[model samples]
Target chain A: MASKEKVAIIGSGLIGQSWAMIFVSAGYRVQMYDNQPEKVITAIKSIVDQLNNLESKKLLRGNLSASEQAALISGATTMSEVLQDVFWVQECVFEDVALKQKVFKHIDSMLKCDPILCSSTSFIPPSQFMGHIRHRSSALVNHPVNPPYFAPLTELVPSPWTKPEIVSRAKAILTEVGQKPIVVKKEVPGFIINRIQDAIFAEAYRLIEDDVVSVEDLDAVMSEGLGMRYAFTGPWETAHLNANGMTEYFEKYAQGIFDVQSTFKPVKKMEGPTAEKIIEAMNKKVPMETLNERRKWRDEMMIKLSQIKKSSQ
Target chain B: MASKEKVAIIGSGLIGQSWAMIFVSAGYRVQMYDNQPEKVITAIKSIVDQLNNLESKKLLRGNLSASEQAALISGATTMSEVLQDVFWVQECVFEDVALKQKVFKHIDSMLKCDPILCSSTSFIPPSQFMGHIRHRSSALVNHPVNPPYFAPLTELVPSPWTKPEIVSRAKAILTEVGQKPIVVKKEVPGFIINRIQDAIFAEAYRLIEDDVVSVEDLDAVMSEGLGMRYAFTGPWETAHLNANGMTEYFEKYAQGIFDVQSTFKPVKKMEGPTAEKIIEAMNKKVPMETLNERRKWRDEMMIKLSQIKKSSQ
Candidate 1:
């Protein structure tokens, strides 16, 4: 009756399609636009396929049936059509800063009313493009991990000029669509997830570079060891549960922990022989020729894991 | 038919009990000894309860039933009895360097042969205690995570004097019992897992202490974001799959990554108000009073995740 609270999704790429599905699955009316009109039809087909796949696996989010949700996603013929009465626009263009700047400028000129402008860039900060825009106060980055349906975290990062209320609204919208949104308070490079990821990767590279452990065994140290706990609990909760409490944990292992932390080497530039060796080993396990198959396996496992996490909670 | 391999489990606490269950579940005759005999009986009861729980969940690792495995674990009247005819000994005394040294010294004197002597310590390096022992060549640390049944990673850390062959054999034995063993090539403090854990924890502490994110959101960045991928793929494989390969990943994001890593603050000591804030927040989610309940929930989720991981593979 309230016209389903329209959302405009620009760029019809993988991320754009995912945003559309998420909005529609939550009963929002979604209008998708692509610079090239033909691509929108292809995106719709892929979205349908993905929705059906999730439905078959019973992993579809929200209460809407696959066809019903798919029916809610429609392509817009013009930027004006896409922005028509929509409360938000999700930009999912290529990660290059110049192209993103141009697209945001265009969107700013076309919009009739102020709408929440969210970018799906994982690297480029909002400050680069949003500072000169009329709707700069509403622009922020909603960086999602790949395959948003399975891994539901969206890192909500706001430009310095962005309104605080818009950040809260974005998180609430993501929550309605069954996404877990975390805020990055200041504009930090890599935001929260990738910054942590780079930290782990730097250490992992050093271990392999030093030949302390082979690449395979090094992987097991995480997938089989630390990952088991981290998959459910974060580092803080882990410390709490590992001992009586945080204070007890520090009392027991603080000095030893410090000693180990000091042993970590400086960040190695990821290149040359070490990178080649890692790539070769990874290819042996998941050959470059069939990388997609391995990714399929990874996604299937992630879906199953997501289900387990939800039920357990 | 070959005889069941015997393993001596000294100090029947939680870690010791887990080691016993794992050994007996693999059809090994497990001889368990504790400083106080009454504690062994209590441990056997808890072990029985754990095995039954695993069995009911259909998550039991080996062919043996809960009772069948429980029947294979017996209390030793003395250290000599526990060491008699045992091919290996897992020392699980309190996590004190001196206490562990004392226990290893007693086991060394009573052993029938130069058995593979491993300590179940999460922190203390084997080099500290094993250096002065008579049978130091066979001594190492076989660190198991808490509730070893669900999280089966065992870090095999060898002292300078530890025999290379013994390390290999220790790995083989752990593998036989369905435990994933990673060899720490050198005796490093905290070994591989804890070192990486400390790195992540240090970053997490800084992020929380700096007010970049709330304690809850920081944990969400891990459990909901990076953790979903890390659960199955390690950092290496993740980078490989993220791009065409590891080389491409580095080519694109290495500079950006280095910039972010350089921004991370020095490790904050886990004391004072920051520690208290984290503890209070954690307690609110999983009350310290019902810590065990939260732990049980964690274990159940882990078991389910393990099953999914195995089947997906």
Candidate 2:
């Protein structure tokens, strides 16, 4: 553990703080950088709160004392200082195009060694910021699921210009740090995860927009039915193991899938009737009077489920 | 346990056997009917093996002895015999349209009371078979995940003609049997699970079909990345809880989702080049050389995962 690599996290909001907690727990010396000194000063406290929550729930894998947690974090005054001598830099700055462009370009300019510079932006591609840069080889998008402190699903989306060696390095580092890092070989608009999410929301919006079912029913369809299976087997594996194998599954049902595909008509921006439908149903399910309480219930369920999953492992 | 219900399972193939195992383990009397005398004679033995496997794996919530298991199964030779005093009837016939039509019609005609008549058919809806029948109000689809002995996901899709009371009854019975069921308010093609699955597959096909990434990387993206998060949270809850609150989440990122949705193109059918891409990629990732071995691994994983999930409850 003394040979732990140094990791840098740029940004001090929820995403960056979460990264700090995870890296520290995974036995990495984490260097955190944020423009606001106040948030940086309290980052260790925030990390402690998260770790305590994990401990109370018996979800903390990397046993760490409060002082030990503090020892791993070094909040730097400058981004350049944070990147200095670190093996990897995970940038969780703002998701704005120009902001990422300015911040990443500066980090790229100051890099003496090309440590993997991964952006935490969910939507934009790496090429959006790294495209015309000099040391763009090390810059790529490494999007993590929100509250990635508990959920370890992290996507390493490499741009077309991203070097294969950098991708491998990023994958190996993330694996070492208790994160499930899957690579998106090609950078689609939202990458693979969000692309699949968009596909799901299209149906959800369409169903609610068309008045086919309630929002609660739509959620239950997944949570009770498909979501449970999905927790273990993916869509492909589910199909492959359904009847015969995947081949026989396609042979019997490919035409059926295409026929269903033909019927899918995506709803427009959830602004007017679609938004009203969701809000109306949500109001009924979780009224504005008790929305805050309902939100806590949701998060608690997520935490409990997270705890259950950890025990399973 | 003494007030437990009875569910008649007609047809003793894989689906039927799975149902028998599910019902018996959930403290229900199961009358299994198959035209083949050999199948009816051996259905109890096979179900015992399945239950024993589940018991050893810690997936069975309730235990039944061999004598008790045999007592739970009151084998019936004909449809009328099986349905004599059954509270629910789940038909898992072959996938022929004509055969399903004929069998469903007879079953609907013989159903004396308003007990639920649920079919485990995938593509075909209740309307296709029971639209003109006398007991159409009690008939609907209750499609379960394959090997329902383990995976408990069931889609309780209702036809337009189906009565509310029947749907409620089916849902309650499903719950007692320890199978998770979601009601599809409308009988849409592909139902809820498969429709969303097709949408994801369509985009995934386009992604791979367009050479965005190879098959293995894409599968890894779901298996290791997004699918892990989805195991715990639905898309709506995910969006709502990702940020501090739901409003902040939607206000922050709905535009990005909308932007991606706006540019999504329609997918071509899986034929020719598109089909070739998937086959080539799947072959490369999960070669036919180790297909049998991989299947064993998947089953073992399913056993472990199901055991873990059941224990947490």
Candidate 3:
């Protein structure tokens, strides 16, 4: 039998741990490293517990048993130890560009092989930090949604200097690990998901500011109406399904959509009284103390939704 | 037992039929009217078949049996028959100002009781057509999401002349029928849902136009990632959970969010090459010939998702 390939996970935080679990689920050896050895050990323990929980709930990804996947993940005290003989290196450190740049430069210096260097930064573009790296051709941004175990959409964004095969390799690896990877052809701030998200949030904030709707009701318009369909379809498919097809949908409602789009207020800083109002309203529903509990509920919901989607497909 | 309140459903189209099923499920007597008597009769049969299908799948809305709900709906040949002694009049007519005005005037001439006159126009504001009605104070817009039986969200938008109690009454009735109602404090074009939806769609279009992402991948970003969390929580709750609270969320992300929002291009006409490209991409995934089949699949997925959500809640 052939030996399994290896992947390196740097900075053993939540995202790093998730990447480790995902890679191991696909039968890859994942060596995780952190400056603080205790954090790496803790992350490995948490990953074991999470994988066990997913297994018990029958939501575990890939065909591997929990114990088999857990066995493939290990902690490394040094970056050189983790990056040795690895085909992929996922950097999951802090979101600071300077910190990331330093880490990437160090990884470039230590690596003997041209492993695919990926960062899990949600906002920072690849060009910002990868510009000075020796192996900039292999460095790219592979931004994953929070709780990648449950929501598996990763944005694979490459800098202008990054090789096309690097992006393709990253996409193949992410797909093999049971994730849906979307390629961003150009380096853009916020990439794809956050851009769409901020567009929705900005408009939502404006609605609350103008007193068109209350905070709770505004949310229901999504969770209860729009978000329900969005779980299964995108805006383009939604438009296609809502009418005869995309052409008919735009032909019928384009003017109205354009007219409403015009009414959107200029993007305002999400502060002042409106932000306070939103904070109060949101905190009232899910208090700061119970945020972790609420997040647990959300993750559980995501898992269940993923199961439902998988079964339906 | 006391008598069930009656609801007059004008225009026996798909929306009108959905309204009938919802009203009957709540034990209301529904009188459906159309200018063409055959259309009303056909709508009733379709409603019965739809109700039975929902029942067989265990996705029916209310406690009432499919037979009982079917028994409560009846066809009315004239406006007077449908309007008599009803506490609610839901106008699900064609999406035209002049046509709606004509129907409202006729409804005003026939009605004896002061029922809540609600238009199911997804786009038109109530003030556009309700301004000249005798019961203008009782008129409002109760725009429902498509396939409301499975995805039950109704937007209650009232005109300037509408009374406060009318809005409250509509809210109560909608709640009684197991629909989520979000009150639009002021009438706006496209109300709340479409405004947020267009905000998302516009940004998505820009991403495609800029060659940052493909049409298929852009949709996957939602259906796979952001939309997963959104299915269970709204933007405000999502933000609150994503951080310590909404305050911390804004404190951490406000600048980044504002920067991205400012980068958003002005909303342009969604025509020309972009529309054609989207049309081609969407049709490739879901052909026009198979649209109805795809719609059925979407509806089924919605039912499954709703069930999952209800069970989890």
Name the candidate that leads on lDDT.
3
Give the higher-DockQ candidate: 1 or 3.
Answer: 3
Candidate 1 lDDT by residue in tens digits, A208-246: 888777788888877887787888888877777878766
Badly placed stretches (over 4 Å) of model 1 are A1-3, B1-3
Q: Tens-digit lDDT track for model 2 on B1-313?
A: 3736778888888888878777876678888888786887787777777566655665554566544655687788787888787788888889777887888778777776666888889778778887877778888899886656555668888888888888888888788777877777787888777777788888877877767766666665565555655654466655654554446656676788888877677866776776766666666656766666665455555555555445555
The candidate with the higher TM-score, 1 or 3, is 3
Sorting all predicted structures by DockQ, with the top scorer first, yields 3, 1, 2
Task: Score each candidate by Cα lDDT.
Answer: 0.85, 0.73, 0.90
TM-score-best of 2 and 3: 3
lDDT of each residue in A1-313, candidate 2, tens digit only: 3737788898888889888887888778998888887788787677777677666665565767655666788889987798889888888888899999998878877777767778898888888887867777777888887657655678887877888998898888788777778777777788777887888888888877777666776776565556655655566666665645567667778888889999998646666666655655555555556655654444444455544545555
For each candidate, the DockQ is 0.70, 0.41, 0.84
Candidate 2, DockQ score (0 to 1) = 0.41
TM-scores, in order shown?
A: 0.96, 0.90, 0.98
* Model 3: native contacts recovered, as a fraction: 0.81
Q: What would the per-residue lDDT of candidate 3 be over residues B1-313, giving only the tens digit for each residue? A: 2338999999998889889988888899999999999999899999999999989988787788899889898988888889989999999989999999999999998889999999998888888899998999999999998877768899999999999999998999899888999999998878998899999988998999888899999999889988888888888888888777899999999999999999999998899998889999998999889999988888988888888878877
Candidate 3 ranges beyond 4 A from true positions: A1-3, B1-3
